[model samples]
Target: MKTFTSPALSGLPGLRHAFFTRDGGVSKGIYAGLNGGIGSNDDPADVAENRRRMAEAMGVDVAHFLTAHQIHSPDVAVATMPWSPEARPRVDAMVTATPGLALGVTTADCGPILFADAKARVIGAAHAGWKGAFTGVLENTINEMEKLGANRADITVAIGPLIRQPSYEVGAEFVARFTEADPAFARFFIPSAREGHAMFDLAGFIRMRLQRAGIVDIDDTGIDTYPDEQLFSYRRTVHRKEPDYGRQIHAIVLAR
Candidate 1:
């Protein structure tokens, strides 16, 4: 399967991660290639097989390849052992210092952020959509990692593919939500051609949140999922009037 890795986390000792694209999998139709989203309408068997591939890539057993039942909330989970799909926690991020358990987050256009503090051997995966980022998922992920003995300054974060500002147009309320939270956030929005609409910079906002959380080592894949054919995008699926959409899984694991 085709995947992207962040340079910041690539050379970290005992770390393995991948920002998987919708490139390789057995599913056909709209769920084609590496649709790891259990909540998606894709065939269950195909999803299992796809996750198995991801687990193998991360050098862990399929059972140990973990992802939460994301709710776009700031909730974070600490994974010490694998949980069944039916039992996945309702959270947007996960952190772990335990070796062999791969933490993953499923997303289409939402940001997938992988974090690692090599010195502490702690790793985290966060699903940072606008709501999650605005509500503190990124900071919560770091806090959870800190609880596991990670130092925020020693942590390195890699932001994976997501909807970039150029392709992410939002209504007035969306812009209002950010600016209302902090007037300074207005800078992340640019007027779109459509009236009462603006392009939102999700990546930039994510980076800002990381920096604000005191994380200095960061990297971004800079891939826009909306226009990238290799990646699945929820907004693209909606624009095309497709009945359902697939999701890509971005994951991290400590191999020690």
Candidate 2:
């Protein structure tokens, strides 16, 4: 299957990880390629097989490739072992110190961020959509990692493919939320041609949040998912009036 690896995470020791794309799987149509989203309308067997491929690629067993039912909240789960798909928690992020278990999150246009502190052997994965990020998912994920012995100073984060600012136009109220949170957030929004609408720099805001959280190392792929046909995109699908869109998986694991 086609996948992208973060150079930041690659040099880290005792870790295996990947940000998978929509390619090289048995799925067909819009869900074609390795669609690992268990919540999509795609056939369960197909998603299962796709995730199985991802598991093998990440050097984990099928049962060890874990993900959660994301609720766009600040909730973060700690994984000691993989939960059955039906049993996954309603959380937007996860952290793990356990070896051989892969922690993953699914996304289309939303941000998929992977974190690791090599010395601590702790890894984290977060689904940072505007809601989750605004609600503090990234910070909570790091806090959970600290509970597992990770250090913020030693942590390195890699932001995988996501919808860049140009493709992320938003309503005034949406902009209001951030500006209300902190006046500085206004810098992340640029005025759009449409009155009261603005383009948002989602990836940039995420990077800023990571930095403020005290993480010393950060890598942004700077790949825009909406314009890149190689990656799946929720906003793209909506604009095209597609019935459904598939999600891609971003995962990290502690090597066995």
Candidate 3:
């Protein structure tokens, strides 16, 4: 199966990871190719098989490739071991320090961030939509990692493929919400053609947040999901008036 990795996390010892794209797997129509979103409308069997492929690629048992329900909240779930889909918690991020356990998060348009502290054998995965990011999901993920013995300075994070600034337009209220939280955030938005809308630099904003959290090593894939046919995009689905969309998986594991 096709996958991407960040240079920042690629050289880490005893870690395995992939930022998967919608290029491999068994699904049809809009959900074609590596659709791993367990909560999506895609057939359960297909999703299961796709996830199995991801787990195999990460060198873990199929049952060990774990992901959460992702409610776009700041909530984070710590994983000591794998859990069945029925037992997955309702959260937007996951962290793990246990060997042989994989932490994953699914996303279409939202950012999928993978983090690792090789020295501590700790790793994290987060779904950073605008709501989740603004509300502190990234921060919460790091805090949980620290609780598991990861140091912020030792952490290396990768911002995976997502809707980039050029394709991400926001309403005035969206801009206001961010600026209200911190006026300096206004720089992430640039005026768009729409009277009250502006383009948002989501990746840049995410990087700044990581910097503020004391993380020094960061890498962004710089791949935009919206126009990339190889990746699934919720906004692209919406714009096409499709009834549903697929999601790609981003996972990191502390290898056994």
Best by TM-score: 1
Q: List the residue pairs that clash in candidate 3.
A: none
Better of 1 and 3 by TM-score: 1
**lDDT tens digits by residue: candidate 2, 122-225:** 99999999999888999999999999999999999999999999999999999999999899999999999899899999999999999999987999889999
List residue ranges in candidate 1 displaced over 4 A.
none
Displacement of residue 7 (Cα, Å) in model 3 is 1.1
Candidate 2 TM-score to native = 0.98
User: Which residue pairs in model 2 clash with each other?
Assistant: none
Q: What is the C-alpha lDDT of each candidate?
A: 0.95, 0.93, 0.92
User: How many Å off is the CA of 112 in candidate 2?
Assistant: 0.5
User: Of models 1 and 2, which has the larger TM-score?
Assistant: 1
Candidate 3 per-residue lDDT over residues 1-256, each given as its tens digit: 7898898788888998899998779998889999998878999999999999999988999999899988999999989877889999999999988888888889998999999999988899999998898889999999999999999999999999999999999999999999999999999999999898999999999999999999999999999999999999999999999999999999998878
Best by lDDT: 1
| Every model's TM-score | 0.99, 0.98, 0.98
**Number of backbone-clashing residue pairs for each candidate, in the order shown:** 0, 0, 0
